[model samples]
Each structure stands twice: as structure tokens, then as C-alpha cells.
Target chain A: MGDPQLSGEQVRQRALLRFDRVERAVHWLNASLFLILVLTGAALYFTPLIALVGRRRLIEQVHLYVGLALPLPLLLGLAGSWGRGLRRDVGRINRWTEADMRWLRGLVDNAAGRRPSAPRPRLGKFNAGQKLNAAFVAGGGLVMLGTGALLRWYVPFPLSWRAGATFVHNWLAFMFVVVILGHIALALSDREALRSMLGGRISSAWAARHAPAWLEEASDQ
Target chain B: MTEHAGPADELPVRGAGAEQPVPSPAGDGTQEPWSKPIGRRTVLSVLGLGALGTLFGSHLQSGISSALNAVHANGIASLLPGGGQFTIYTVTSGYPAAPADYTLRVGGLVQRPLSLPLAELQALPATRLTRNFQCVTGWEVADVHWVGVRLVDLAAHAGVNPAATAFQFRSFDGIYTESLTIQQAHQTGAIVAYSMLGAPVTREHGGPVRLYVPSMFGYKSIKWLSAIDLVARPQPGYWEQNGYPIDAWISGHPPVQAA
Candidate 1:
């Protein structure tokens, strides 16, 4: 699919698929739900916010229904044949290789500005940080769902359990805000990565430098 | 003289071995009632029932506390059945119901103390108010139709003494209390409300009777209303003592005409 005038290297520099249509769609849906949950949760939790925007019952219902629907996109995506790319990415996130561990150690050393003991480990579809973020988000989502359910339908729970759920839910939500901000900042700093998320493509040159193993795997496919 | 005619002579003494005509199959007549061995199924059933009862009781207690403790905590009890978008709050762990012989005691500094039943309060002049109910925590139910006797009319009937400058409202829940100045009590929106939304106020919604202070935040309107003691001064209520303002006018301004 290269132009006849273009060299092989120039053709390789052309854009390649990073995320498929279904994966991109799922990611955007999840992001939108997260935004809604955070805003509604803040409106419910903050007295000043409540005073300023005073449709509390409506806001509360929005928060509840949106929270209940948070996991739908991912679950539905995984269920269909169209979700092959998403399912593959999920497997990559779940697996941690020796290279992944070395990448983590190298990351720590790089942040500390120390000299590399060995060459930087090649990355796959996701870096170690990305894997950790995915794991934490998935785990945190489950925790939030369990605790949110308890807080919402509190009658069957004990006082201590409800109290504990509230404590966890509040703290986790604050952590989510911080983490989301960090995620957005990091994504913004890497325009190519952010573009891939938004439009499902990245330059082969960008993929080769960042995820060489993934680039090789894609070429083989 | 009537000892022979008594019904005692016609009955047999059961389980009294010497007086028994026949023994039961399960136990000898000589066995005392307590000595009869219970069946395994019966014991298991009893244990099962006891467990079920304990579980139900615990959930019910938690549910009640969840509904009642909404005032102390943020974002609670809205999902409770029959709460109707209003967060139910109580100082106590449970919702106290009006007693079978419930009466509103109007005393303290009154010239003529009166104990009025629900019927008596309903019998008095009824004022229906359709105004917004605002909670200090910022939830509101608009245009609630309240039906009851006006507090001023009740005070007039009880003959409030000149020394009485305020009204101290007591709740059947026992822990909750609210105070209103004589002027606030005389406001057109203030009433000992028996009905709301065209029906008797529900127990969850502080039924039988509750103070409806439409001009002020909901905390000023006491629930499970059991008494209205004409007092000398406005006393800080349960919420007030817990850092809520005593004069919680909605939107930080008293109503222009109790609307």
C-alpha cells in the first residue's frame, strides 16, 4: 500500500493501527462514564457544590445510574467477536514478562537519573506503567462498585460495614481524581499515544521506538 | 356453698400419673412436661427460625438506623422504601411511632394545659399549606400540601401565659427537639400537621403529627411531634446543638409571606 515514488523506510513511517474501532469506542465510553461519575459524586459530596447546584435528587439519581452502568462498555466489548483487539490487549495487560520487570526497574533508575546497567528492555503493546495503571483501574473499579452498592443499598449491611464502605468509596474517589489527572497529563505529554487513543492509529516510526516488540508482532500479522 | 357446682370436678388432671386414665405414646405419664424430649426436626426448625429472626432483626435495625441517621451523615436513606426522595433523619436509632393513646401535651408556661389527641387536633381549624420544604443539607420537596391546625390557634386554645415567649417541640422519638420563638410559631406556615400530600403523614415521614415549618429549613420542623411546651425562651434543638443554625431560613432569607 506504499506510493511508487516512496522508499521502503518512508513507507514504513506511515501510520499503523494502534487501537481498533471497538477498542477506541470502549475507551471513550469508559472515559465519559468516569467523568459523569466524578462530577455527580462531587456534587453529592460537597456542600458548597450542592448549594450552588441544587437539584440534589436528580444529581444523585444520575450518579447512581451512571455508576451502575460504568462496566457495561467493557463487558459488552469483550463479549462480541468484534472485541478481538480489546481482548488481546487485556491479555497483554494481564501478562507480565521478565522484560516487563526489567522495564519497571529501568523506569525507577531513569527517574533517579542513574546510568543504565543494561540496554532498555523492549516494550510490547503496553509499557509496565500502562500495565500497572490498567490493573489498578480494573481492581479499583470492582472495589468502587462493591462499596458503592453497599452505600446505595445500605439496609442489609451493618453500621460498621456501611461506615467502612463510605470511607473506602470517598478515599478511592479522591485517588481516582488524582490518577485520572496524572493519566491525562501523561497522555497529553505523549501526543502520538493520545492521538492513537483518539483516532486508533500511530506512525510506524512512533510504534517502533516505543513498542518495538508490538511493531514486530503487527508486521508478522 | 357452690363448691360442688364448680367445673373443676369435670376435668382430669393431665400427666398426673396417679390420676391419668391413659399415658401418651411419646412419653410416660410419669414424665414431667419439661422432661419430654424434642424431635431433631423440631429443634432444627426452631434453630433455623431463630437464625432467620436474628438476621431479619439485624437488617431491620440497620435499615431503621440508616433511615434515622441520615442527618448525621451525608447522602443516606434516600433509597429507603417510602422515604420518597426525602432523606429521613432521626436523632435516635429507630423511628418512634405514636403510642396507641398518643396525646400532644400542651403545657409548660400555659395558663390551661391541654392533652389533645390526634382527632382533637384534626377537629380544630385546618390550614392547608402548599409550599416548598427545604432541608438545610440542600434537598427540597416543592409544593407539599400540608393539613393541620395552626400552632397559633393551638396556642390560643391552650391559653398561653404571657411568660411563654417560645414553643419547645418534643418528639416521640425522644432524642429530637426543636424550638421556635412565639413569633415564628405564629407564622402562617407553622402548623401541627397531621396530613401531607393529601394523606396522613407516614410514620417514616413523621406521621400522626409533625410540625410543618415551611418558612424554615426542615430541621426546624420537628418529627414524631409529641409535645408543644410553651416555654420562656428559644432553646437550641438537637440539630442546633450539632452546629446547625437555629434560624435556618431557606435561601438565607425568611419568607416574605410564608410562601
Candidate 2:
């Protein structure tokens, strides 16, 4: 039963809104900040780039300020709209059930494009892979904050502890970069997925193929 | 796929039919847009890029390092602290002067107490040591060549007292002081520095004669010239009194490395 459409104002209303404005804002803001921290942290770890980065003291001061401010964007996102927007997404990212393990089983194949015809399990809001990535990023952020604080001499820890912190900070940051690059590569490969992240709408066909459960749930809401 | 091909279609994620698979694209997945998985080809491609990155990165690094080395060839960075100009860390309003009446008295528990004017101090044979100078506050200046009488040599001239175990070094500024144990005082790089880079050490750099201890942190290298009094025990340095370690290493590494 097709009703007579109001033709003047509406263009196309059929697309799904996969991400709201607040969710996109938080994701991008966190991404950009983390990226800068990663670059500067890498420069510090490497001896070869010291001169290219210039004025070790000045560059280090910049690194310290950015590292300290890392949590501000996330906190603002959570509190800006009284925890309705970003906090909900965070919940979605953190939730895990037994079904997620089944989703995980196919991740390697999915990434490698080995099994194209297999039915993607009903992944709600986020797949198990995304959940794991989110959890890893959250845990990584805490380690960086703690270890960074100690290295910067916020409180007087022993020299040994400072050295230990330095070691952890370097290794964790390297692993983080490798993982983030993989995340970026996957997102860029899937056109609709990247579009959903940007303007928060994805074609229903892409939704059916990848995230059927999420599409069903959104339609009900 | 060729470089000119539409970037997004490099490794098509969804091929046309359900029954048959598409031919995998040859060559490093880096050339292709993202549909390439973490397969053998992809792994090798990343390693290839890493090797190339190392080659390119080292090329850039060497250019910068060599230029830096040329600019700072003769232990000059040390004399010109803070990358060219000296960094002042004095507590007093101004640096103390070495009035021509200036004499460094070596008087504590020594058999021969010698007071030498600056000119007389200059007459002694000079020994130069170029080493990396590091501060406890986490700054470093490399290749500082200091020309001065070794403290051990001076100790030999004055005949150090049998029981004396440490030397308390006083700065001309009076407020700053540091100490070195007998072993540290006799270490290879310990000196009463009077000249830097073939010139008389400037007042900005803690001279008439400042002590240079390459192994210990810069704080122990007490700038400004004055007196050395032998004592029986270790006294906390000015910075040490304010939470700095007695064993500050320039490398920010271990004390053993200083050895």
C-alpha cells in the first residue's frame, strides 16, 4: 500500500541511520587524538627520528600535553548529552554473549576473503571482532595513561619503575599502531561500512550481507 | 592489478556468482585496495615495505646525524650547553666572579695545601677528555671536551690525607656544592676544568675552574671555581637535598654503564 509521497521536501528516506552524530563525533575525535599520540610516541621510541622531530625537550613537552588530554574527548562525548548517545554505543561495544564466539570463528576467513558465501552470523550493533578491538583499545588507553604519567615524573617513582614504564609504553604503542592500521584497512575496503561511519547511513543490501541482526533491531526501534 | 586500475576494485570482496571463486590478484596487496586478507602474500608485502622503510628511514637519519656531527665535532656541544648557549641553573641573583685575587685553595686534610691563581693553574699541563654530558633533569649535550688538571693528579701533587675519603667541591656561587667519594674523585674523567674547546672556560659555563665528572650526573660536575675540602663522609648535594639521586647517570641508564 504505497501512500502518495510528499514530493517537495523528502529525497530518499529508505536508508538506515547506522550511527548518530554523537557516536560519529566520539569515534573520530578519539581516533585523531590517538593517532597523534601514536606518532609522537613512536618518534620518542626511535633514536633515528630524534633530530627530524627536532628539539627533544620541546617535542617531548608537546607529547606530554597531548597524552594528558587523551581522555577529554571521550569524557565529553559520554557527558555531552547526559549519556544517551555515546554511552549507549559504548554499551553495545562492550556487551558480549555466547553467540559472539561463533562470530569470532569466521573473522579470519572473513578478513582473508577465503569464505565469501558463508552466512554471516546475526551480529547486533557490532560484530565480535569490533567488540574485541574496542576492548583492546580501551585497555590500551589506560596502560598508556598510567605508564605515561609515571615516565613524565608526575609523582616520584623509582628510576627502575620509570624504565619499566618506558618499556611497556613503547611495546604497547607499537602493537596498537599495527592493530589500528588493520582496522583502517578493513573500513576503507568496505565502501558502505566506511560511509556508515562517516554520515551514518548504509544501504540495506550491505546491512543484510554484513549486519542483519543490527538492521532488524534498528527497524524495531 | 595494474596501478591504473580503479583502486577500490583491486580485490573485489563480493564476486558475481555464489558457486565459483574469483582468481586471487597477484603481487603485494599494498598495491591493491583493501580486500586483501592477512594471507602469505600480504605478510610478505608488509615485510617488503618494512625493509624499504628501513632503507629510506636510515638514509634520512644519516644525513641529519652526519650534519649534526660535523657541527659538533670537537666536544663543543658540552661547552655550549643547551644546544648552543649555556643553561643557567643558579639559585643566586648572579654568577660569582673570579676576581684576579681568585685562588683555588686545596686545604682540607692534605699534606701540602696549595693555593694557585688562575694564571698558575693554567701553567699546569692540561689533559682533555671528551665525553657525553648528561644532566639529572633529563637533558644531554654530547661530545664535550674539557681541558683541565685531573683531580687525581692534583691529589697526587697535594698528597691526599690517608684518612680522607671524599672531596667536597664548593662553587664560586657559594650556594651550590657537591661531593665525590675517593673512588669517584679518582675516576678517569674527573677534572678541575679551566678551558673548553681550546679557549678559557667562560663564566657562563661555571669557570675559572669547574669540576667535570663525565660518569656522574651534571650536578656532581659543580660549575664555578673555588675550594675542595677533603672530608670523611658523603654529604648530600644541593639538588640531592631536594630529591635528586646522588648517583645521577648522564645516559639516564645504569650507574654501571658509567664505569
Winning candidate number (TM-score): 2
**Model 1 DockQ class:** incorrect
Q: Estimate each model's TM-score.
A: 0.50, 0.51
- What C-alpha lDDT, on a 0 to 100 scale, does residue A82 get in candidate 2? 52
lDDT of 1 by residue, B177-211 (tens): 89998887665358899999889998867888999
Query: Candidate 2's residue-wise lDDT over A1-221, tens digit each?
Result: 11112222232235777788877887898888887887776555443353245344456667889888887777776665554655555655544433354577676667887774445445555666786676666656666776777666623554334434543555467678889999999998987789888998876556555665555555445
lDDT of 2 by residue, B1-259 (tens): 0111232132223211111122337664422222222222332343344334322432433344455466776764333212322234444444556776889888787899989888888788778888766544333455777889888778778888888998888887768889887786654358899987568887757777898887776778887869988878868887777666676654444455322
Looking at model 2 chain A, report the run of 10 residues with the lowest lDDT sum.
A1-10
Model 2 CAPRI rating: incorrect
Judge candidate 2 against the unseen true structure and give its global Cα lDDT, from 0 to 1. Answer: 0.61
Best prediction by lDDT: 1
Cα lDDT of model 1 by residue, A1-221, tens digit = 32212336774677879899999999999999999999988766654455456454567669889999998898888777897677666656555544566688888888999987667766666776886677667667766776777656654554445444554565568777888899999999999899999899998778677876666556655
The true-versus-predicted C-alpha distance at residue B129 of model 1, in Å, is 32
